[model samples]
Target: MRGGPAFEVLFNINTYLKKKGLRDKFELTFFAPMEKPGQKMGDKALLMMDKMFKSMDIHKQVGSKIVAFESDGIVFENGRKILSDLTMFISAGTGHTILSSSDLPLSEAGFVVTNEYNEVEGFEGIYAIGDSASLMGAKWRAKQGHVAEVMAKNVAYGIAMHIQNIDSKRSYMGQLNILCMMDTGNGAAFVYRSEKGGKMIPLPIIGHWMKKAWGVYCKYSKLGKIPRIPGM
Candidate 1:
């Protein structure tokens, strides 16, 4: 696991497996290159993860760079190998190479540089949202679907205001936050993080259903088949 929300989902799944007496049947191990994975969620979240790892009997290998993946398992740069029957790896996302050849200003990672309202520099009315734009705030900032939605809405509002000659404009900067419902097979956790702090709330059975409903709502809302709630 590469850490963040994806790792949290796996952690919750491990807990569910243990409660169902199926943990012994499967070997689950989490590995990351960073020594302190999930630390970006704040100190409280980091402590909670540490506690969960101990109480759930989950194995972890950190601070080790991965060199390659063999048929059996992973190979580390330190010449250490861990054999496993199955391996699940989640790699980080990168910008498209096509952005490099475009006229837009790009970050070193090749993401389009944009203002707070997602307006691409030197491109006046043009805007770049979603993973295509480079975030411009905290170092721990991540490209998430919710943040992309925020940017999209902001750009839309900005465009409308411009056409109407309204002084009002929206910016995605103040809206930056990590909000996720990490689901397990049986339950889910509400994880939230902002500049002030971070909090993780355990939602047992009902949480799973809530996440499922959210998925349904998102799908229908995006297709305009159902009405979307404000700030959803």
Candidate 2:
């Protein structure tokens, strides 16, 4: 549906399916080019995905197009297959289809092109952020929640700075990192990834409680009853 790691989206789908009691009728699978995919989530989460898939009767396969139909659950380039009743597509790259509707300049993938500070070159006062803007950093740079939030905050700050007659603006480069708490039924794994690489730390039942507490904190803080922790 949107850019970011694929696991998060799959997790949401799985949760929804379980709630609907159709989780058994449908066989959930993860298809990618790599045989040992999900390195983005770190080794533990990757291993956990393997375990989860295996336990749930989910299949894993490598493919090029990763196609699916009503009769066949999914099909790959090598004649390999996994039958499914339904399928949904999610891309972790420039959401080009939507950009084709606009008149803005586009990359090969059709995302809007912008300067280092997120300004459109010839269009003053107009800016693009998040999934629509072309990234100025590494190609592996992903569109994540924090990046979107920071971009929004930076854009706001840029406006304030402009009103104060300032010259410089904020840059999104060097902010490439992934931080997330992965919840399992009874525990969680705290994952962090940066230029240095990645790490995943497992926690027991307390981790689940921490996540629940975090949900409450998030709700209360968003409603202005509590303060939000920095970098959360």
Candidate 3:
């Protein structure tokens, strides 16, 4: 329960209701097995999140493991049952099932083991990147698009250097950080967490377009119709 998608879902549902002017007519609740779902974002962000929930009139059911999902409600390990007519559930990330049968080394969570350069150790010339590779670093680190980009860029550079007999390389290690632009229907929020600390910047109408602009840039850059902004 890293808390990213859950918050997104909460905001999305809340926004949709507000747009229809029915926000006050419905009840919303957030449930999780962890005491703090988005703990990785640091204490400040977590506090802000709690405040957001309160402002939106959303209830919280946290800190107990879910044991069952009944027809009319969900049950928690602590004997609490939440009644609901509609429910949206999101599970935590896990390695692919195919990796379970492979001989490659895997972490306890089942992700493929890789070095900072994304190379598979003991398997020369082989590499595993993106969500396929087990992240090497602090436990708080969660996979993000920027981190995947760094890994892919590094692997490409590493392979080219191998072919040219160059001894140069790049690493995703130095690039690890949390970057997310969460859309809240009418606006968005810019969240960033680096080695220095974590920060959640509120962005309204301008922030919404900022994320949309990036989406446009990303699509065109991938299609080779426009040059990508360096270090984007």
Candidate 4:
């Protein structure tokens, strides 16, 4: 998912299917290009996740190149074949297909070129924020709303200073962080990371309600029915 890790997305889908009494009817396996995907979430999170997946009977195929997707399943470069009834794919990061035809400079992933302040090079008064901008950070880095929100605020400040003839600018570096509220159907986990490292705190029933409340707030705030809570 755009907001969550591929493992979490696929696992949740499996959870949903299980709720319909279909757990024994399918073989669910999670695949990713990264060997240890979700490392950004923290080592503790990954350790916990592995045990959780095993308990749920989910298979994992990661850090392996997919040779091909045959009619029955997947073929790996190492001659490993996993029979899968269906396959779902999501890139780590990608851009619109239309961007490939545009004149704007693009990264290897097809995201737009931009400076730390989200300003497009060779084009004054132009900016690329959110998923549009080529991200800069650790291999564990991800493009989440926190990063996008910081870019948005910084771009606004940078443009305002430009108009005032002030030689000032703000960089999104150091401000962006990894944050996620993961729901496991029953409860949830609060995941966060920064220069100080990362943490994943498991929350019980209350966590589920908290996430639901946030969902409602997100929906209404986007629709102008309510104001966004600060630093959300």
On TM-score, the candidate that comes out on top is 3
Against the true structure, what is every candidate's RMSD?
A: 2.3, 4.0, 1.4, 2.3
lDDT (10s digit) by residue, model 1, range 1-232:
3366567566766877778989889877777777888876777877877776776677888788999999999988888888888777777666798888788898887899999989887887989999999888875566789999899888889999999999877889998888877776576768788888888887878888999999999999989999999868
lDDT (Cα, tens digit) per residue for candidate 2, span 81-197: 766656655654654676789878787877889876787888878888888887667533556777877887788888789989998699777677777766654566677777676
Alpha-carbon TM-score of each model against the true structure:
0.89, 0.75, 0.95, 0.88
Query: Which scores higher on TM-score, 1 or 4?
Result: 1
Tens digit of per-residue lDDT, candidate 3, span 1-232: 5468768777988999999999888889999998888877877888888888888889999999999988888999999999988877877778999887898899999999998989889999989999889998876698987788889989999999999999999988888999998777667878888778888887977887887899999999999999988767
What is the TM-score ranking, best to worst? 3, 1, 4, 2
What clash count goes with each model? 0, 2, 0, 0
In order, candidate lDDTs are 0.81, 0.69, 0.86, 0.81
The stretch of ten residues in a row with the least summed lDDT in candidate 2 is 1-10
TM-score of 4: 0.88
Model 4 weakest lDDT span, ten residues long: 1-10
Candidates by lDDT, descending order: 3, 1, 4, 2
Itemize residue pairs with steric clashes in candidate 3. Answer: none
Candidate 1 TM-score to native: 0.89
